[model samples]
Target chain A: MKKIVVSLLLSLSLLGLGNAWAVDSLNISLAPEQANPPSPQMGDWLKFHSVIENSGSQAAHGVVAWISLVQVDPGHEQPVDLEDWSAHKAVTQAILQPGQQVKVEWPMRLIQAGAYRVVISAVDRETGHVMTSPFVDFQVRRKPVVDSGRILPVALGVPMLVLGMMAWRRYRRRTGV
Target chain B: MNPITLIARKEAGELLMSGRGLAWLLALSVIMSVLSLLLVSNTELSLLDNAQVVYMVMGTVTALGALLAVVLGSDAVAGERERGSLMPLLLAPVTPSQIVFGKMGGQVAGWVVMYLLSLPYVWAVGSSGQNLTQAVAYLALFGTPVVLGFGFLGIALSARLRSVRSALLTSLITLMLLASPLLLGPSLRQSAIGKLFDAVNPFSAAVNSFDSVVIDSQPLAMQINRLAISLVWLVLTAVFAIRSVRKMEI
Candidate 1:
């Protein structure tokens, strides 16, 4: 009677653990999730491109995106809370459907001029699956602006200005400037 | 003949005889047409392109018309005053209002002629993009007045200075001074300063017209604000120019 009770209890525990959950019928791939050698100019606008693909047999829905700025080489993650950068959770629209690949544009200006790494990935908001892209690397250095040779417009504009002034002054003088 | 119509014909006829004026007018249309074609083609590649191309071309045309109007308008009264030809016109039977109407008509006609020449490119942009008919109609109707308004404003300023050279320079200088305020401006329709700039700036008004017609695909009725603003400028310019002409001392 003691053995029978013990066996019955053990059987119930095993039955509970035996129930199965279904496997995901979708696959996701990310393209160039990292950007290297980013623009070094201070206050310069930056845009990086990421492409997403649904490789699985089943269509995926409710895709979500995640991007983080990280230190390169050592790979420390999520240094910048991009949500704080914008007043919204995501500056971009949130939802994407499966088997419908779309490009994601990630734009961020460097807060400090130095080396940095960006990691990007996506998952279905409904199903928790991560899609990671190839890593891209970027470096920050001094970007030249108005440091060398005269810009064409100003260079060209000077001559035009001279002529215009001369012509204008003459015109004004004749008719009383 | 109506006083306005007579003046328009006479001024347009005078401009026709001017080789430099004709050349500039043709060049402006060609450059604008080519630019319109390039811009339209570029926008055709995108789904969200707006009526900016037409805005740009019209802005250029209106700016030119305004500058020309000032240069020519100053020449109309100030030149006559300087050359001492204004006295005879003052002695003539026409009233200040009639003279104003005539001068306004002529200036308006000059702009209309230049606008008509750029139809091919203008229409092409419309046909290629959205709202081709609406764009053309807007340009034909409101655009003419916008052009006239700019011209008249330049002339009005010219009249006040009593010197063609001073009037032209003042108008051009005013135009140059405007660039900073426009770029730094926020909310052309919302802010008082921005609205004031739009009210005074013919180029801005013309650009607004294009945006309404081509980009927004809006009807002529919707553009009344811009048209009305432009007409007010035109009337003001006419009133001042006519007064200056009638009060001629040469």
Candidate 2:
């Protein structure tokens, strides 16, 4: 009985260590591309590069990586949906070999003015383990790209001009002007 | 002037200079103006991506253009017949094909005016975004075929049907059926049947092309398949319209 109990405890400890090893095998680092503007304005395009390295002896299978944005403003903080910013949000790697490193490039447009932190998160489907990169902070300054005042004149004027012309043509035909 | 040109000019003048045509154009401009103002001035909508704004404007313009085409095309033969004016046109020195082409020219004129009117709105919403030129170009490229195809479909129905009301109703219903796929969510659209319908739907092709070019920043080479679908619609409808007019009595 004593020997069996010791064997059971030893097996449990090995299984826990294996699970921890799988969880720590993948490491991710994310950063803005050097070509990106240091101070981005609203409507500016930005690119980010993330590198995922597998350091363990076992390979990572069915790994998926995606970007997440969090607005860290003082008064309002919330996670942002990337639906408008990017069409291809998540990328998958079928199999990542041991000691292999893969790079992902994400191109996004800054739509609103705010302080944001972006992070790359990855999950290994085989191991059910997740890893996240350190957040990269960025600021998008307010730049009014659209001028409604300019649009108002054309939007309102064109129709009015057409109506005036129609009325004038009718009046001329009636009076032979 | 050639018979076709003369007939085209007459049809265009009747549609553009008439009170009904003026009313349709006016309504189109007002709707566009209100939509543009809201998109630019609203706090939430203003924050949307510029390419998204452009895509929305392009879609709206195309829909409105198609609506105008259907209205005018439905009235092409049936309205004239109802007013006892089609007999004189039929007796003129023009073939059935020529009449169909001339009426199509009128629809083209209406589309041109609508496209021109939409330019300011497109520019206002999408000037700051990427693919501005591509958006404008694709709108013209894809919108022309889709709008013209709807016009041809309307003309075909009008030639075959006895009354303008029935033709217009049927055309409107067909338009709604074709446009229904657009309202489906992405998940639903990815289903097997949905994907199959989208593959053949010209409306989907145009809107999807706009999304790809404006929002996804895809190149023009990628739009060949979708453009082909739209072109196929145009060809099929044009042939149907010509045949229907040729077989019509009185």
Candidate 3:
């Protein structure tokens, strides 16, 4: 009985030490609201919801979370201007507790259609440490080319005729023909 | 026909047959064809692409129209004086105002040719596209006055100068000076002088108006300040041109 009790006490103390030694860290995840409309089109307003989790034992204060649209270029990624992209409601969570999470939303308008990556970054004010989430691949497609198929020829032809007549009149006058 | 219309028709015929007219037409055609092909060949379409193309077309057309005005009106009186034809023209039944109006009309005809040349390209990019009609309408509305204003200024400078070469040079220089406000950097553009220049300059006003209407998708009513400024400039320039014509010798 004594041996069994000592064994149990040792295991419990070790578990407590392990729990006490746990480090503080922040985690973030971003997700789009709907499965449908998976890809955003130009001029479409998209909502990105991000969950910021404090995976550590302590509370995090002045935790700022921001979402950014980035274009992956050769050898580097360029940040798209939020102003030009029509981003709105970029949110921040002031306080997050241990094992607690807060949700933030970024409502952005897809102004220019192209391939991009959505990135969410959280900065802990106390530690001045910044944590970034994995890139969310995205593509914006252009609206289909407007078929003005029949109108194209007429549009071109009428102008050509007008220009030709003007030129011909000038030619006749110049040559006195 | 009105005296202005008759004189305008005669002058337009002369311009169309001239070497410069053919050159401008050829250049303009090539530009429009290339731009249209590029715009249509693209598989994906967006409002920005259409707006950008429209903006490019507007800028190119306006600059070219201004060039035509300078080329055609710069010699309205000075070149005639140099060639000893001013006396006969001034002695004709048309008054000085009529002559000015006639020459202005001829420049306007050139502008019409440019506008027509750009229509197909504009249509290809803008038809059925958002803000296309507004872009085209703004181009026409503000574009007409811009061309007319530049033509009047060119004719005024030509009337004031004695030599064709001198008049042409002076008019071109003045155009460059007017466009300087647009070339300034962002920091400088916000300065007092920059603000003053942009407020009074017709070209800048028109370009800003285009931005507001097309890119911002603002209605025409929102562009009253810019439109008003351009109109004021147009009137001032026209008045200056008329006064110069009246005071012109020979």
Q: Which candidate gets the maximum TM-score versus the true structure?
A: 2
Q: lDDT order of candidates, best first?
A: 2, 3, 1
List, residue by residue over B1-250, the lDDT tens digit for candidate 1: 7766776677776665454555555555545645554564442232214345545555555555555666666676677778786677667777766766777777766776666655555544433334557666766666566556556666676667778778788777766654333244235356877677767665566567677666554667777777776677666656666666556544
Report the C-alpha lDDT of model 2 over B61-108, residue by residue, as the tens digit: 989899999998899999999999899989888888899988988888
**TM of each candidate vs. truth:** 0.53, 0.85, 0.70
Instruction: Tell me the docking grade of candidate 2.
Output: acceptable
Which ranking of candidates, highest DockQ first?
Answer: 2, 3, 1
Candidate 1, DockQ score (0 to 1): 0.03
Ten-residue stretch with the least lDDT total in model 1 chain B? B42-51
Any runs in candidate 3 off by more than 4 Å, and if so which?
A1-39, A47-65, A71-79, A87-107, A111-138, A142-163, A170-177, B16-23, B31-50, B83-85, B125-130, B180-199, B216-222
lDDT of 2 by residue, A1-177 (tens): 999999999999999888887777788989899999989987788999999989778998888999999999998799998877776688889999998999899898887899999999998876665789999999998876676667788788878976876797688789998
TM-score of chain A of 3: 0.62
Fnat computed for model 1: 0.00
Candidate 3 per-residue C-alpha lDDT over A1-177 given as tens digits, one digit per residue, 9 for 90 to 100: 999999999999997765443324677888876842776677677777788889877787788777778877556568787765654535576788888988777777676667888888877666645677777777776665355583467446654755786688668878999
If you superpose only chain B onto the true chain B, what TM-score does each candidate give?
A: 0.78, 0.95, 0.87
In model 1, which regions exceed 4 Å deviation?
A1-177, B1-7, B33-44, B177-205, B219-222
Residue pairs clashing, model 1? A34-A136, A35-A136, A36-A137, A36-A138, A37-A137, A37-A138, A60-A98, B51-B215
CA lDDT of each candidate? 0.56, 0.86, 0.73
